[model samples]
Target: MTPSESAAAASNDTRTRRSRLLDRVVGSLWPSMALHRATRLMAGGQAIRAFGLFARAARAGSAEAEYQVGRCYLNGAGVPVSRADGFRWIERAAARGHAEAEWILAALYVDGVAPCCDRQDSSGSPLDLFSFDVAPEPDFAAAEKWARRAAEHGSADGQALLGYVLTFGPKSMRDLEEAQHWYKLSAEAGCPQGAYGYGSSLVQSGDSEGDEVRAADYIRLAAQAGLSPAIYLLGMLTERGWGIERDQSAAVQLYRRAAVIGNRSAQTSWGRALMWGVGVEPDRIEGESWLRRAALAGDADAAALIGDIYAEAGALPPNYAEAAIWYRRAAEAGHAAAARTLGLLYLSGTGVGRDPREAMNWLGIAAEAGDRSAQVDLASLLLNDGASHPGDLAKARDWLERAAASGNLLAASHLGVCLLEGIGMDREERLALQWLHQAAREVVSAQYWYGRALSEGRGIEADPSLGRAWVARAAAAGMADAEAALAEMMVNGRGGPKDHGAALDLFERAAAKGHVGAMYALGMMRDGGFDVASDHAAALRWFEAAAERGHEAAQHIVGHSPQQNVRDDR
Candidate 1:
């Protein structure tokens, strides 16, 4: 043969071999391809003619084809999805040993896919993922069996799933050791999820035992792999120093990274850090920005934080109107703090109009959700009201007690007052004093009460010197009542040596800052000619100012004064 003819012959042989190889590969893939096409159609995504072909391949005992076709039927590809048909085909493929089918079945059993056909109903120990689903009765129990079989066959996903099932199955099936074995197997296969599960299993006993470090390590690995769950877990561990040294800065960085990827938990944590300056500088604008973003994304924690920031005034406007609006937004999202704030606004005419009934409604929701602030506020509302208050003093006391249990000093202080006043409990002077002491150690209001009670001998022995010292300490700590009492004692030489000039200076300063009691006190001093050369005109001026500020006694005094009548006629 000529050299050209020889080359041509070689080329033709190569072409023939390539064509045959292509045919073989296509033969292997055609069934799954057809199923993929059917799935697209049923998903309302894309329509094609591969649905019938998939059905044909599935019925012919091709396990790969059965798995693919089952997915389509399960998802309503081309036709309406039939849970019954989907389960049947998948089960058939799984039984025939299709690797993918086995894993898919395990997912279904864990996720609680609805049963549309008698086949799934008949063939399985019907397992619902949660108690919310109805338990099945036919009792094939094949799901667990198949999952174990797939795990035994070395499917990492199957092994992880089997681990979970064994750990949490009904009493008859629960076996922690079996779960641990499967989880370790899957983790050894380089499954990050499996590693996380194994680590969590180690901590089930609640002993640190280095399980936290191991869990954090696995969580970091999973997060690096772009698993949202792992990302959240890593942030949690870092923030809490759980199983490792607390590294808030590192946690914040991780939270930011996860938040950028649309993780709600990360968003909430990031927002909190910005709000509180925890491992970051406090930035109200930035904090509110993150919180708004998270709240829009449906994060309950962020919503609650936003409500808190808007309700309490500092740098933000003190418009209770706007505060009420934000509180309502958060309350609607099931944030108890927000609900409590909303209830407060209603109770006190804060950012919203006062309505005791509405306050009770929102406060009740917060109290039910274990908000300490809500408990105390709700208790106060109930303890002071008539039948229309909507809550009994016993219930109020219960709420207050719970708040006290949570270590809220204000709640403890108020609770002490309730006991002393017989508002919620009998007057147990010793118990009330004990609670007051506890509260005083934690809060200034209690400190003021302690001093006042000691001064008046209310439920305790009166000791003027001790009262003076207590009130002085409270005054230094910025309590208005303490300041007034101490100022009076200073002028009269009751607690300590008289300092008349110093008392005048203190009263003037307090009056300038709008202290009603201070204004009234200064007016009396001037009227009595004890502190300011008997200046009745100046005394009348001070009284008028106090009266304008809603001091009822000052108003009455001014009304009886001849100067007030003369001014009214003018």
Candidate 2:
């Protein structure tokens, strides 16, 4: 069976939902051969997708199938329309009490497409022919008549469609209570489209809306049936723990299904999940590919995500050139992150040529958009405090305050530094410590600050062990100051131990990761021959590396010449 047909045949799956009743399912359940042929014709009789079911329905001779066939004829599907034949099939189905057929026949009669047609039923029942015209209200009358019949016959799709037509189509055709009744019936009958439409309609335009339980059930059912819209919403709710517990797994599944079904929003969301390894295995290539697809599809958020992945470190890590590309794309797509990153690239000469003016422009856009990070960076630039950007302390503080309030770690860290140094502001130990602690959770430099605070009892109780632990973590993360702190502790047995061997190993690792203190430590290590041969040449080289960074200790050791530092005394 075609996927569409399979979808219909699996209606009892109790998991399917969608905006419309699937034609394949209609074909499978139909009992009129002629009508089945019509539905098949509507699908162009191709063996591509959704074809097998139409063929089966055509073979079945079902009423609904016949109605579909009639629709195809009216719309000229796969062949030239035969108005007479269209009316014939519709009339035949309507006589069999097919509501959809009745509606179609009514439209044909109203449009005067068919005339003088005799109506006959499968059971040989006959009806008197009447002149119908769009001007005479018979079309609306017949539409309502057939809708009532279909709805009364427990056709969920009919009920939902009728409710939609009644609620939104023509003002003269509107019926609030009737629309509500049909929608309710369809929802109860497990119609995916009906449930979502009803739920949205109920809560639309007002705060007094949303039956989470009812909506969740229908959304879940429809999501299972591969309904993209419902799946996207459900994924959002689940991810945020809004109407359900934060279920990364469920969210990922919803996103995947919707994305596969060509839901633009879902594509971005699913890509993000894959990229972040939130509820699925991290797949950078796939994630990036999907995100690109979404961005191409005009999804702003997806564009922004691609930009973020490229410019800043995330699930796939960072690549300045790739990030530059993504950031530019996103900026063009009107994403704040993209704009900010563009500015950053320009200011820092990262992947893009440095242009402080362009950077200012992009940052200005993001700052106006209320991006806390952008605000902080831009404000700092205005105040001339960070990364060679001009300084404006007051303006910078304003942005910093916003960022700090919104829990931006970098902003908080910068704020703490400002307070501690009394730079462009008065000292505020308590607030500075709080911000430092917050930033310390993920920032090595911030951790060092907090560690220093703990060690000095600044704005908090002194705890040497706590301080040491924080410093150790920062050292492991390769922070220069932290590495120096740990090395000193190891050498002096201040925190926990005095292991020169351990200290030397840490120094080497940190040096490899680009910690300047670690380089100096390595120089000292070579000078003392702690773990290697007493090689004065190597000692001089190590000292030279640290000296390049203007390390005072290394400079003093190296003195005026590399040869002199090699120690002929050895």
Candidate 3:
């Protein structure tokens, strides 16, 4: 043989080996290639051809082809649906280590769409994504078994899913500690859902030993990975300065980003921020629209916000009826403020019909939850209506004392009145005066009682001059009783100097407010010419007006007076 012939023979042998290697590799990939072609054909509407190709490839033991064939049979895609055939094919592919096929078969078994497989397929148990709920009976026990198997096989999605199933599954099946282990593994493997799950777990652990810091770190990773819930949670933490610096503007932006991706919590929060100008310019109508979207998605907070918008009379055209409806919905969903508002509305007969029992029921819930305003209102109602029942007054007093201790001035004043009047308990005059004195500095009504007590020496040393000054202060604040008391004192020179002219002006002012005593005093002044020129007709008119209003003294005088046509000895 020649040298040239030898070199050509060697090249041909090498080329033949390379060609055979390429053929072997291509043969191994042909099933996947055929499945892809079939998918394209089916998508292009050539269903019959696609079905034939898929069946052929499936018969050749192609796992991808088998999965496609199973899905087609199950859903009746260009063929009569045959669940049994679909199940058989999917199970076969799953046995051959097809991840998607395994997931489908597991879902079928767990959901009871297909019979449960006890120790079945060799390629790990059935593990499914919850997003695909093609059917509905859930067997968490079977799901747990299958998901654990998938996790053992090093599937990131399977590990994450296993963690979630175990974390939130039936109490009997839940193992939070084990679930956290799987979540950490899946998160390290770069699964966004896993990171989110791990973050949530750490956040809920309530262990302050670096857990919050860890949670924030994982949550940030998940949010960057585009997980909606993680984004929303991160926004909340940012807004509240929980394990992060408070950045309300940044939180609003995060909420908007998550909202755009259809996160319900983010939608509600963003709407609230916009409505309240919390970190953005107020846009009530736009905020309302977003809140409506969240409410439709079953967000209780959004519903509560809508209720507030309707209930605020000065902020919007008051829609008490609509407010009641939203408040009821939110209250039923366990919103504390909504429950309190609903109770107030019921008590006031603003939106719903007056129903004191229902009002008390709602208020009771809010009071138990530590709402200060609810405590005050509940106490007032109980004191007014519970006076006839033994021990009920004590309960009312307890509530008043609680509210007063919480720095409520109105509650303090009311408590003083209850002590002084002995509405439901024995009167304690000294204690009443102490409370009255405390409230008198801030409350107009309290001033009257405190001043009267001082003047009459009811519970304290008599200080008529100081008492008159206090009464004058209350009268200036528009208390009709204080005005009448001060006027009489001035007329009689009881506390200070006699000033009938000043007394008559005070009497006229009180009379203008329909104070019966002031009207009778004005009649006497006119009849006697004490402060002004006597006018018989004017005196008769004032006395008659006072008498008509059930003034006994005025009535007695009117009854003894002569008729208009008769003469009277002056």
- Candidate-wise lDDT, in order: 0.76, 0.72, 0.82
Better of 1 and 2 by TM-score: 1
Per-residue accuracy of model 1 over 1-570 as CA lDDT, tens digit each: 999999999999999789556434544567555455455544655432345556655755678768767887787765576777788788889988876688778777766663534333355755322223456432225557777878988888788878877776676887888888898888888887787678667656446647667776766767877877677777888888887678899989888888888888788888888888888888867877888898887777777677667656786576667667767877887889889878978988876778989999999899888887888888877776643443476788888778787788888888887777777567877677777778988688777777767777778887777777777787778666677778888888875788777777677767877789999988998888575577888898999999999999999999989977887999
- TM-score per prediction, in order, is 0.68, 0.47, 0.63
Work out candidate 2's RMSD over C-alphas.
Answer: 16.8
Better of 2 and 3 by lDDT: 3
Lowest summed lDDT across 10 adjacent residues in model 3 is found at: 127-136
List pairs with backbone clashes in candidate 3: 106-126
Query: Who wins the lDDT comparison?
Result: 3
What tens-digit string does per-residue lDDT give for candidate 3 at 65-84? 89888998899987888877
Ranking by TM-score, best first? 1, 3, 2
lDDT of 2 at 46: 42
For residues 282-392, write the lDDT of model 2, one tens digit per residue: 997899899999999888788878767666665556788777776777787778877887899899998878889889889988888877788978876765444343245
Lowest-lDDT window of 10 residues in candidate 1?
131-140
